[model samples]
Target: MPPTSPSRCRSDGVHLVLPIVERSSKEPSAHEPWYCIIFSHRLTSSPVESIQSTFSPLSGLINGIFFTVIQINTDVRSAAALLDQFYEKRRILIVSTPDISNQYYKLQNIMVQRAGCGLDLRQVTVIELLGLPPREVGRIKENRLSSEVIEELRQAMRISQAYFTMVLVDKQGMDRERYIDPVTSDELFSYIDTYMLSTEERERMENNRDHCD
Candidate 1:
């Protein structure tokens, strides 16, 4: 027991041990790993074509187009509805043209002016003058000849007076009575200022105008 007791004494003792593994301090945790995913769709060259192509996939991601027209009242709702319907179907073409006046060519001048600012006038093609009274259509041709109307048209269209005069001559053979008077610079400026103002401000101005009057 004296000689064997040397090894027997160590066997009765208990020992505590722990295991360790080396890891990078910069490594993300299993619950906090970095990850990213991306998705994309191709588009066509033409804006109209691109709109049509990407519409299905991108409709949910984009606000649909808005169009304003001047004289063609019927076309406005119809066009808007068409665009809405197309967008709902995930397909669309945002073609917009000003409403052509069927009542008086005087209104058409205003439409032309607005159209010039908002649209490519050259792309406009004459379709059948559907549902318009013959007299109304005739009025458009007749108004093109009037010196006063021509001048008003030029001013509103923001083009040279001479250009409108020539356009009138080319469109209509003879002159007619001027329907709209020439707007003064003050009047024009007032209109522009009103246009630039917010809806509340415009309403206030309108109320003030009515009260003053």
Candidate 2:
């Protein structure tokens, strides 16, 4: 089979082509070996259109080949734009990042996605100390901050603090299944409520309620 033309290849999609080679025995009397080639691609389209287009070429390739794996990658900006085009007013954006700078960039993209026409930015929450290992978690619990990491964390926090309403969540006991332990959540929230507030800031925010109304 010939390679797919670049013009036919969709920009919003990926194309994968696998070639199969058959091995033959050294003896001239030996039969020729036959093998199967697999090709797969993921395209960005509406759910219905994606499904319909995916199977058409696949069906022509094999008589009874079963699809074992299918993976889809979506452009976050495009997805958000599509939602906005449909007049989605409010959206809950949950972004996770190992670095604070990436988190801020993701937040900015969300903001850009919802630009214009009464799209209010609400609920900007930040989760610090993400992806901490178990030993690191123990050290944090014991109030021993690594000097090197403390400086890094401080720098990250300084960069991200302005854009987000920061919340420090203790990531102890959080694994693949459980995101944050209930005890950790409670403790973190309590600490925030207790120490993260200035009386003047609180009063100012309370006074601004009339303006909001």
Q: State each candidate's clash count.
A: 1, 0
Quote each prediction's TM-score. 0.21, 0.18
Model 2 C-alpha lDDT versus the unseen true structure: 0.27
lDDT score for residue 15 of model 2 = 23
Candidate 1 overall lDDT versus native: 0.23
Best by TM-score: 1
lDDT of each: 0.23, 0.27
Model 1 clashing residue pairs (backbone): 72-99
lDDT of 2 by residue, 1-213 (tens): 221231222221222322212243232111111111221222234323333344343334322322221111111223222223212111222222344455554454354333311111111122133223333210111123343443344343332322323323222211112121122333432343354435643453344323322
* TM-score: model 2 vs. ground truth: 0.18
Alpha-carbon deviation at 117 in model 2, angstroms: 17
